[model samples]
Target: MNADGDETPEAAYRLLHERAVGQSPTPGERSLSAAQYDSARADYLAEKRIVAKPGVAIWPPTSQTLMKRLGNGSWSTAMTSLGLTTNSGRTRGTGSFSDDDYRSAVAEFLDAAADGDNRSVTSDSFAQYIVWAKERTAAGAKRPSGAAVRQHFGSWEAAKTAAQA
Candidate 1:
C-alpha cells in the first residue's frame, strides 16, 4: 500500500519473481538465485514501461540494492536469509587449481603483462592482471590470484621460475 494504494514494490517484485521462476515464493522466502534475479531483472527492464502514476514507472532496484533493502541493510545477510547461493565463482582466493594450472596461468599472465615492454611481473602486477582477467573471462576460466599463485609455489619468484621451467 504505497501512495497509490497499489501493491507495494516488494510485493510486485515478488510477483515478478513468481512469473519469472514459474513458482510462488513462500512467505519470507527468496526463490531466485542471484543469477536468476539478474536475468529476470534484465527481462523486466527490457519490456515496455508501465507508468506507476503520472511520471513514475514501476521499477525494481538493482540486485545489490534490492537484496540490502529486503534483507535488512546487508546484501549478504538478506541473501543468506532467503536461502540463495551467494558464491560468485569469480571470488578471489586459493582455489582448487592444480600446480600445473597455476604454472600455466602464471605464464599467461607474465606474457600478457610483458606485452611489448620488458616489465617484470611483480606480485602486485600479477594481482592486477588477475583482477582484469576475472572481468573479461568466465568465472571458471579466471586466473588464480597472485597470493594463491605465491602460496602454491611458496613464493612469487619460485612461481615465476616454475612457470618458465
Candidate 2:
C-alpha cells in the first residue's frame, strides 16, 4: 500500500472493504459518511496519485475508478463484491413495492407529463416526479427513484413502454 504504485487494485478494494467492515451507520445517518469517504480518498491518494477531488456524487468517480481497476462491473456489483450495502432503500428486487405499483406510478407520472406539450418521459422528469410525489403523496406508499425505476425496466424507454401497456 505504499506510494510506489506496487499495490494491486485488488489490494485497494480489500482496503476499502476492510474500512467498511462493521461500519453500519445508525438510524438517520448515511451508510457511508463523507468522513469515511475522505479518509479513503486520503489513503487512495497516498498510495496512487490521482486528480479525484474530495466531495460527494451520485456515483463517486474515485470509487468507480478503484472498482474498475478491480475488474468489477457496476457500482452495485462492486459494492456486493466488497460486502457493502448501498444507501438506497429497498430495490425492486428486494420487494419494496410490487411491479404493478411501480408501473402505476410511472403511468401516472407519464399522464401528467403528457398533459403538457412535453410527452417525453426522461430520467430527469421521473426523478423530479419522485421528489414531488414523496412530499405530496400520502405516507406509506413507496415511490420508486429514477435509478430504481430505470433498473426495474432496464431503461427509461422500457419503463415508459411498460407503463403505457
- Show the lowest summed lDDT stretch of 10 residues, model 2: 25-34
Which candidate number would show the highest lDDT if scored against the true structure? 1
Backbone clashes for every candidate come to: 0, 0
Give the backbone clash total of model 2: 0
Each prediction's TM-score against the native? 0.43, 0.52
The runs of at least 3 residues in candidate 1 whose Cα sits more than 4 Å from the true structure, single-residue gaps closed, are: 1-9, 28-30, 50-58, 71-76, 80-142, 145-165
Q: List runs of model 2 lying over 4 Å from the truth.
A: 14-39, 42-61, 66-92, 116-141
**Per-candidate local distance difference test:** 0.62, 0.58
